[model samples]
Target: MEPPVNTIKLSQTAKDQLLKLRRHTKIDQWNILCRWGFCRSLAEASIPSPVPIPADSNVELTWKVFGGEMSDILILALKQRCHNDKLGTDKETLAHQFRLHLHRGIGYLAGDPNIKKIEDLIAIATKK
Candidate 1:
């Protein structure tokens, strides 16, 4: 399946947040942290606000790089989430929503005071 976006360009703010997350969690790959952020936003009940996020950072990841082996599943999840939100699954909509969720999740993760290590990330995943 084709990804919603070929290249995911992060905002300057997102780059900063990811840098902070890297320092705390010791996760070196941007793609891995971005995947976590995307899924984290997906887990939320509300839709991310459609704010403009400038692609001002140097960080860029191909869809394949970002999703790794789970590219198809991630696309499916994104499509399903769009459907659940009553948003059409067009390329534009998917791309827009993807950015929104990714940025929001990064912000959420970076802002959380409890995320001090990789174990904290696991703890979040295991939490009910």
Candidate 2:
């Protein structure tokens, strides 16, 4: 399946947050951290607010790089989320929601006081 967007551009704030996350987790890859953030947002019960997010940062990645080996599955998850939210699954809607969710999730992860290390991140995923 084609991705919602060919390229993902993060806001400058998001880039800074990811940098903090990198320092805390010792993870060097932006894509890996972004994947975690995207999934984290998806797990939330509430939909992300459709606020404007400026792509003011130099941090960018292709969809392939962002989703890595799970590109297809990630796209499916985004589509499913849109469906679940009673939103259209058209390209525009998918792209919009993807950005919202990605940013929201990154904020969520970065703000969590518990997330001081990679194990903390794992704990979030493992918790019942």
Candidate 3:
């Protein structure tokens, strides 16, 4: 079965931010960079405001390319987040929240000053 989020089209800003993140972290793969961004956004406690991410650029990826072997696990976690945030458990809501979190996470990684290297990401994870 195909993942609920079959394709991801990032905003122009998000694409630019992801490029910067790639340059800094030395992670060239878009899927890997996006995984970091998505998880980073989810790690935050606040609900992301619903904003439209215009697919202004050519950046797009299949869900398998994005989630890879962890697609099922990521789907489950996204569904749980939807339930927790009262965003409804329907497929549409889950997809919307997934996009929101992915964009926000990319922003988090792009905006963070402390994440100069891969080790900083690990440090942030271990910090209490």
Candidate 4:
């Protein structure tokens, strides 16, 4: 039997951030959350679980978005991109940054050994 689909929980702030990312990148929130969970588990060796959503006592819908590993990866990617002026603004840089994480994140979710070596591939891919 398939496991129950856990409702993703997000704090109002995190939810807003997630929605903003989704709006700018045109990526679905659900997909991004799944990717975030993968990146968190693989990069940080911690299992991420959603906290009880706040709307009602009985409904456990929203999850608090903590666990900094994925965010750390994102920050690094943005730093690297911006250090070289690869993207002109923080908005564009962040979008591309999320794309990079998505690539690595998918690899992690799929159990690909290549996930562990993404930086090398990225280096080659980005080389002129």
Return the lDDT, model 2, position 20. Answer: 98
Determine which window of 10 residues in candidate 4 has minimal summed lDDT. 58-67
After best superposition, candidate 2 residue 18: deviation in angstroms? 0.1
lDDT of 3 by residue, 1-128 (tens): 44667889989999999889878888889999898888887788889989887878789999999999888888887877787887796778888899999999999889999988888877877889
Tens-place lDDT per residue, model 4, 1-128, is 11112243333444444444444345564444445533433353222222332322221232222213444554454455445544453555444433344334433433433333335334433556
List clashing residue pairs in candidate 1. Answer: none
Model 1, 17-37: lDDT tens digits are 999999999999999999999
Q: Tell me the tens digit of each residue's lDDT in model 2 across 11-110.
A: 9999999999999999999999999999999999998998999999999999999998999999999999999999999999999999999999999999
In model 3, where is the ten-residue run with the lowest total lDDT?
1-10
* Model 3 residue pairs with clashes: none
lDDT of 3 at 29: 91
Model 1 residue runs over 4 Å out of place are none
Q: Which segments of model 4 are wrong by more than 4 Å?
A: 1-5, 45-128
Please identify which of the two predictions, 2 or 4, would achieve the higher TM-score against the true structure. Answer: 2
Q: Rate the local accuracy (lDDT) of all candidates.
A: 0.97, 0.98, 0.86, 0.39
TM-score of each: 0.99, 0.99, 0.94, 0.29
Candidate scoring better on lDDT of 2 and 3:
2
Q: How far in Å is the alpha carbon of 85 misplaced in model 1? A: 0.3
